[model samples]
Target: MFMNSPVPSSIGGIKSLARQIKHATGASHAAALDSAAQTARFQNYAHAQRMLAVHVAATPLADARSDLYPLFLTFYWKDKESGERGRETLTIQLSAAWTSLITAQQLAHNRSLYDLQPMASDHLEGKHYCSGQMEAREHACAAARVFQFMDATRLRPSASYSRVYPSGNSRNCIPHSDHPSVWFDPATRRYLFVDEPYKRAIGEREEQERERWAISHLQVIAKATWRGMYNPLQQSGSQIYFISHAFSGVPVKPLVAAVDGIPLCTADHWAGESATATPRFNSPLAGQPIPKAKPVPRARMQHDDPARPPLTFHREAGLLLNKLISLCRRRAGIKTHLESVRDVLREFLMRTSAEEDVSDAEVLAIYEISNTSVKPILRPDWPQRSALEEDMRKLRGLLLQEFAFKAYGGALARHLGAAERSLGVWH
Candidate 1:
């Protein structure tokens, strides 16, 4: 069925594929329909139908460039103090989201080293104790969700966008654009956070002092028709690459195996067969109770509570104000009118903090300013004709939407409604 693996572009072709699947597997028609849907990466027949109807044949249905694969990362470590050597592996399905395999491998390696360096301090410090394999792996995974991994956390939220994954904790979260050190090329849209291990350092000064892992072996256990790989034994699938890298800067035996899929044992490495031997030191946090994650406080109310306006309201209002200022700064419009709108937006921003709820009084004050300071500027008959009339009109529409919130109910909302009507803005 995967031969050439071309997805059906038409409903007729889909039905025909469904028939083929039904005959080959002796499955029910409905089961065949679902199996056929999987070929397009949709959840079911109905979902495929809904997406196909709106998007048509031009939509991306199983494009290799858009697909994400599973990634498997394995790390090897040795503690010199007790002569303990160990190896551990972690799988990050999210890592496959990086479409470029080369970039994905480098990111996985850099992020893993950055995360594990602290946990394996003994290796760097020449101390007598080794680290717990499980604890280090756990920490690396947690840190990966915030930085190296891409999803809702790394993406900038759009006004109407919804995400499948829950937003990461904002306190620890730093959006990609806001990251301090990571390099991003706006032209190519490439992130150059990790140095490419495959390439050699050009000069002595360019050589990093830190210890890191280099991809020594990589293979795809099961090559899918799509661009990525999968490991059936682990019940894992993705643009997954099973990777093993030996630790450099410190002498450590690279865990060797006869083939990609075969399990590494004591006999595999040329070193002594002591893979089962116990390490001298235990994990510092091994016996301690795992700390529970603190519940994040609600920044804004879900309902339009008068006392607590939705956070989106403040954000949108501020954005609208900023837009007004930018448009006015063009200076092509009437000087007085442009300055008046800019002053009103600046005042409103100053009075209200982005972090706080915009109260009814503040809302009323800004609306009144819009009527007094801004309305005259937007007048079509105003002397010397404001070139920004169209821009101001659009801004006024957004401003009205912001002020028309139900949170400022009762007399305030009523008065605002009257003010909007006078400005020729309907509810």
Candidate 2:
């Protein structure tokens, strides 16, 4: 990922050349003044400096400190809204790749709260925010990746060097040092950016903030990728469930009594009565009293009483019979046949009431015999009574399936066993 760049040919004599420029230009006075101004600025923003410095100082160095070497050089621009212009500052740092430099520039541009680059001295009303010292450090750290990449090249510098103030602005001019662009510390083995001011301003712990920022950026990227993948299915009513058993534990059924108005009963009322019952015992009377107990009359139980039609049967049959009687009264085309049909229905019910088990086949045989009796009064196209008998059979099957009676019977047996165990009862 490192961008290739031609190495400077002569780096050894750069120190002598820098000294010559320093002596000829006589710019030490100006440099001293700028340094004093920077110190004053740091003092004025003590809180910010402290925050950034502590962060930078806590960062772990990558390797043992060694000779410093140049990594990257970048420029920034600053403009004032009040028509007052600002001087641009070139940020120099030791990194392994140019990626860091690009990241730093992007970050600076994103932080709209500050007018970065020119190092504004005067605070503009409503326009000036916090100083860009933090932004500068951010840029320098990002650019460190370039230096790291460059160090891997292992090219040594030669002494032949030249000095030139590429710009005519006196305020923007900076001096070069004979020190290697970056050096590795023996104890920490980290390449240090020799700009003492910038390093101190950034401090060590700043990497944590950078890491947090990177994680957030990654989250955004992941979300965007997921959204893109699901875009085609957005309109369909489908949903994706991302379940994590580690965090949520196992799934379980809720204890509610019903789903959409259907009731679910537990073992407490399995058969609409308590499972246990008290036993009743009758003792034989003494010899003197036993003789008088023989004549006691037996009371008839409800099951042995005279058969009365079920309420539902009475209601529905009466309604159907009444409709047939109305047709007879109207003297409709099939009046006699309707009357015969009504009589047959009444006879069939009477016979069914006497039977212990009215199976479908038996019911169909009854319907056939009854239809014969009424056949002479009806048209040939009239439906046979056996059709109605078959309909009843189908209805019975549907009701049984809908209620799931057989399945529930098994469930009830299991629940009863569980309850028995809970009650410490065997059998």
Candidate 3:
């Protein structure tokens, strides 16, 4: 049920699909998984359609022609490395959210991107953003909640008007008209970080470099997505694609994946929630601490960031290794050796972070511990000693010199040989 598959739009139809999947006893072993996947599938369609109806006010063409792409929603995440939910696995689900592109095209346009700031430059002077047919909540063509929630790690906080600071005027705002942020223009099919306004902020050379970085980033996210990601919470096929990063240190990844039935906002806030929902703290009339207001009750969405770890396979392996370790200790008998084995297991797992590796001494110590524990059970014959020597040789294989600088060859390695042999798939 992916990659351009037809999906039901109505809630009733979506629920029915899930019910059918669950009832399909023919798939007994994975009935629950099938049901959840179907449910996610249907929700994905609705969000994709939402994207199509919206217009992201990308840079207008130099020839005065409108330039916009039918945005394809994809999941993206950042590693803690980039201070975004960036530097992590990016995902793009194959299903294009809508069951029918024609139907999506008919929906009322609801939002715009990158053009939500106070003013536009002479390069984009006549460009405009649409709030569509909804007029009630549309102010300044952008809302503080939308900006903040659209990207959790991107925008600087409280730069926008606050509900707490309602008395303050818009003069406190520093407009992007001075240094405009950039985004990918779907219509032009070009990274749109190189407009006149941006050139004024970073010189032409820096702007060009930023554009290259953005392209390389797009490729990187796409590669990571294709490598695939598993949302432990959702248990479905997903890929998070890091979309656009601002020169202003605002990182944005726009994708449509619902977490716990609530659509995730790439920003700090979810869609439809207002910046007023949880406004910044108001300053006291003088220097005194401001009185706190009772928080407004709102539905909290469970976010399934595709970039979150430990990933499915590695985590599965970790669980299996833990089982193996437990079994080894139970059989090894000697308590002290079991303790050393446990340390061996723990430190090797640290290699998963790619920051550490196993030491030769530790490996040999573990080998000795295993040897000590196993000797008592041997028949005290040539065969027993031969097996012991062979096992020692195998342990040496687990401790390569190259492992000294990198993460350890884990318990998951097939060459873990005798130590892990008996535990095969037990966990």
Candidate 4:
């Protein structure tokens, strides 16, 4: 059945009606558009319907197919709008079937923004029906929900529109793989590029914290590196991460190239050591267990000055020993409560290998000192030579035990004992 023409060839009237229909993009405009179709103003009605469908395509849909296109088509031009009734052989039932054909085209038009193109020749599984064919339509059903997370993250305003990629421009309709380092979720109506940005933000925050720790702890080594770099994003292996000093497989370091023995950036540096990417870095194989610091031998006194007391360079004990030895040689003495203990330490080290550098730990098993005043107390002046010697002997035993000098004996231990016995006899 054809729609009853209300006006007799009213061209001006049709133009006026189309103007009114153009104003509405929602289903509320359907009644007015259908009424115009009955008045032989099908051009205006078709124009209005397509315009509304385009807007609908851009907006999120609760259900794409459940819209006003078909309802209005039949309301205006009943059964004739569908072209023909029974078709044993396929043939065009009518020449004027724009109302029926274009009404269904809303499904295609409603999806105008999304253009699906072959990303990679991956094994695609799809289904077919009698009406037509489909390519990646299956993705629409089982798509990943991304907007909820985006909303929660507040990275972008959830209520606002987001820029989708393949970009309707990138030449490829679908994302051609992804943003290299950024993860892309296929199911979200729009691709979610939030993961990489979040990871990058967090990575940078942690990197800064690691840098501060390294700069503070590594001290001079860090300063030397800064001086060598001359300031160009001076982040180092020791700065960005502590890097287990072993390959653990998450892409912390990138592979590098070198020119004339000078190193270049790694695969990670060029490609970007972004959160999603793995980079190879250059480092020495977890270097030989930091060679047990070869016990630095002391320098012998040039002339024995009785007043000054012929002294030898001392290597302090425990962790601070290395730092103190490195410093005391260049700078003047610093007075702490451990001053006397340090002096005693110097005397012990002077006579340590005075005979033969014995490597036997069990040779000198120490019994604990009965003198409990072992605290490193400050003394203004030396006591009588004999008293100091007696105290020194006890202190030496404590030091030997504390430093695990289990085998500290033989001719050297004999010499250390002898040297402390003679002094300026102060008492």
Candidate 5:
């Protein structure tokens, strides 16, 4: 069946049409995309892309002023190192209402943004998006859902004794022959659970014999409606989602079932210095009921010294410094002045690893290598002159008095003043 000549105006519309194509023909995502393009009389998906362009006048989905119903997944675990208990929730906006079940489910299964790629790190889950906040009751409810899921599923037990290998040192390294306890099986279109060691510790006897363990009582509960996305244009105009995860004491849940004779516990308590007590987990199995969620603790701000500005302030300052550095490099007479500014900002930006230390020459080299033209010193309403000026003023008001900023702020301030006089961004 052919769709009208032009493709759907919105990403959501295209996705909906693709789902229909997928269901009717049982086509893969890429094949469905090709089928969609064919509907518009294009040769293939790639051909359609070549003929199409984003409607620039139309506001991108991210900037749309509409109420978006976001899907959220919260994880609860105990901090292995600090023994601190905390909870984190990550969200992705799917539609305007929860009733858009099909659209949400499709996206949940297909989009890279929806996959909670759990990683071993001191910080929050490496793939976790920016931090988010929800109500205490909601947090508990999400937590309980995860706990109940774990309670119902029986994980394969860790071997009582096994030969320790030299290569199995990394906390994240799964044995070559072993599969993760919870995994999405594409062929079956279901999340399957098997009886296996969900997490374990080993005493390696190579250079030194020591015990290494993964996060204890770590339970992951991912709930989604549906999933798929434009893979090629992920960074272009795709919706920007805030991703994040949290680790805290497992929330309380009633015992659902037991493995062997031992009962499973999902009480809110920190995992002590023993590995035997940590409860194993499995993914939400296919055809299982979603347990109703209860209450959990609300999110809290990490304590930080008031004297130090946050990462955003560091970035805002870097933006102004970047403009100054760019201006210096553009003018042959002032090219010599570029090094001092670069050195100062590079040190400051790199201090927190917030930005890079690319020199002006390097930037130009990169542009050349990438086959993209270096932007002009100024473009008409390009950076939004008014916004820059306002940002500068606000930054000055906030950072000028800070002790840390005082070290290099004066030099940057002078350079910015000169740039304003010459390029006319800051009035």
Candidate 6:
């Protein structure tokens, strides 16, 4: 559903109205444009009537704020005469068929928001002399009523608002049109973002700043209404279900099957090693037993590290692990065991570094032995490690052999020769 503000014929007209209202009232140019936009969009009587018909047809008998509610639509247009300013607000209720599909609670919730007091032109006309407090009180009261409808209907809260229009050279409508809104879930008392236009206004670099402000404001409101309620679901273990697309490459597998009015465990239920047990499948038509397919020999592996690595590496690895874990968590899919390979390498390095008494020759011999054992573990299809090793060897030969330990040298020749001999690479 859409919530639109009034549209101005030109940005200049909005600024002019702002200038006219600035001294007599404390209104800014931005505020004027926003007010003008809202009036144009939602105050038009004809648009409101049309929207009411649409809403009734779309969400008849449904709760006002239910998803079944048609877009909370609004529009902006100029008055035919005077050209002073105008706005329109329209809410299209849901049809009976749609309402029938949703549950009773959803219908109740939809009615609350959908049954708002119609947007009257008298409200806009009063703006000429009404104080900011008076106007704000009216807006808040209307919004509160909408919220009450949402609470009574028990609909999940969500809010959204559109961007400012009448572009360029116009006053910055960003501050005026931007609204911070939320749907209050009284059960948890959490105020989640229902409409946050400011987030869409700022560019990508300023997202964190905008999010911080939004989160902080929501927290304050949540704390006031219900102590420590702002992020309970996020902080707690709440499983949010989302529809998966085929392009996402997530595997879908059935976890349970219904047979002869009994629930049968699928292959996903058993441990990866317990794939041998074949449950008997009963067919209703034939009344004969059908053997279940054997579960594949799926290996489950985990990484065991004695010490956590540095924070930088840990953060990078944690991000990668999260992605990998998500892939592996899908039902019936094969989970690759890469964590074991990382753990083995980490342990080997730790052991080698700890044993300082070993001579350089002994260390080289150990490296050769471990390399033989570890090479097979590296993927044969990829040359990741071999390419890295070759690059390092080439760079090392160029810098240390050709440049640092060259036969021709000045006063440091003796020291260079000694260092090269110690490294056991000088001819």
Best candidate, TM-score-wise?
Answer: 1
Q: Per-residue alpha-carbon lDDT of model 2 for 72-142, expressed as tens digits?
A: 22222133344322221222222222232222222232222123221111110112321233333233333
- Give candidate 1 regions above 4 Å deviation: 1-68, 95-135, 146-148, 151-427
TM-score of 4: 0.14
Q: Total clashing residue pairs per candidate? A: 5, 52, 23, 13, 28, 46
lDDT of 1 by residue, 1-427 (tens): 7566477654556777888899989999988987776555443566456445533444564442233332333334556566666654333323133222123223333322333322221111111223644433343333333222222113211111111111222232111111112223222232222112211222233222121111101000111222111111222222221111111010101101101222111111111112332343333233444332122221221222223334455455444444444433333333334344445444545555455655666654442324223333333343223433444444444443443223322233233233323333311
Count residue pairs with overlapping backbones in model 2. 52
lDDT of 2 at 225: 11
Question: What TM-score against the true fold does each predicted structure earn?
Answer: 0.25, 0.17, 0.18, 0.14, 0.19, 0.20
The predicted structure with the larger TM-score, 3 or 4, is 3
**What's the TM for model 3?**
0.18
lDDT of each: 0.33, 0.25, 0.28, 0.25, 0.32, 0.27
lDDT of 4 by residue, 1-427 (tens): 2234234123344445544655643334555555454344222344334323433575543332222221110000112444322111000111111122222212222121122211111101112111211111212211101111111111111111123222223342121121111212122222222111122333556546544432222111011111111111334322111111011111111111101111121212221111111222111222223222122222221111212111222221322332222222222232222243444444554455454453233112111122333343233245433444444444344343232212222232333333343222222
RMSD for each of the candidates: 23.2, 41.6, 23.5, 30.9, 25.8, 27.7
Q: What is the lDDT of residue 29 in candidate 3?
A: 29
Cα deviation at 231, candidate 6, in Å, is 24
Angstrom error at residue 135, model 2: 7.2
Arranged by TM-score, best first: 1, 6, 5, 3, 2, 4
Compared to the true structure, candidate 5 yields what TM-score? 0.19
Query: Candidate 5's residue-wise lDDT over 1-427, tens digit each?
Result: 6345345533444556778888888989988876665454333455334323222234565333232222333444454555644454333222222222222232233222233332211011213322222222233233322222222221111221111111223342322212222222122222322211112222233102111111110112221111111111222211111101112211111111121211111112211111221243222232344322222222322212234344455555555545534543454323333345445544554444434444555433321223224353444364656654554454343343332113454564454345444445322
* Model 6, runs deviating above 4 Å: 1-46, 53-191, 194-201, 208-427
